[model samples]
Target: RVRAYVPYGKQWYPYFMRRLAERPANVAFLLRNLLRS
Candidate 1:
């Protein structure tokens, strides 16, 4: 349900904020990927 909603690299702060809010459970894992880009 969540992976479908993740933002691609081109998306910036707003995208990160939205996804984080939408899935706090995955914040750490998602943040790791975000930083890797």
Candidate 2:
């Protein structure tokens, strides 16, 4: 079993991006989103 907790607030996206920037795999995910936009 696995569980995750998510936080909700106005600042969530920046904080989330900061976290994703720390990992290489997540960088690809982030770039894909940027290109899509």
Strongest candidate by lDDT: 2
Overlapping backbone residue pairs in candidate 1 total 0
lDDT of 1 by residue, 9-36 (tens): 7667788788678987788886788999
What are the runs in model 2 whose C-alpha is more than 4 Å off?
28-37
Residue-pair clashes per candidate: 0, 0
Q: What is the lDDT of candidate 2?
A: 0.83
Superposed Cα deviation of residue 20, candidate 1 (Å): 0.7
Minimum summed lDDT over a 10-residue window in model 2 is located at 15-24
- TM, every model: 0.39, 0.51
* Per-residue error (Å), model 1, residue 5: 11
Best by TM-score: 2
Segments in model 1 whose C-alpha atoms lie over 4 Å from true places? 1-11, 28-37
Q: What local lDDT does model 2 show for residue 15? A: 82
lDDT (Cα atoms) of all candidates against the true structure? 0.76, 0.83
RMSD of 1: 5.6
* Candidate 2 lDDT by residue in tens digits, 1-37: 9988575699888888788778879889868999999
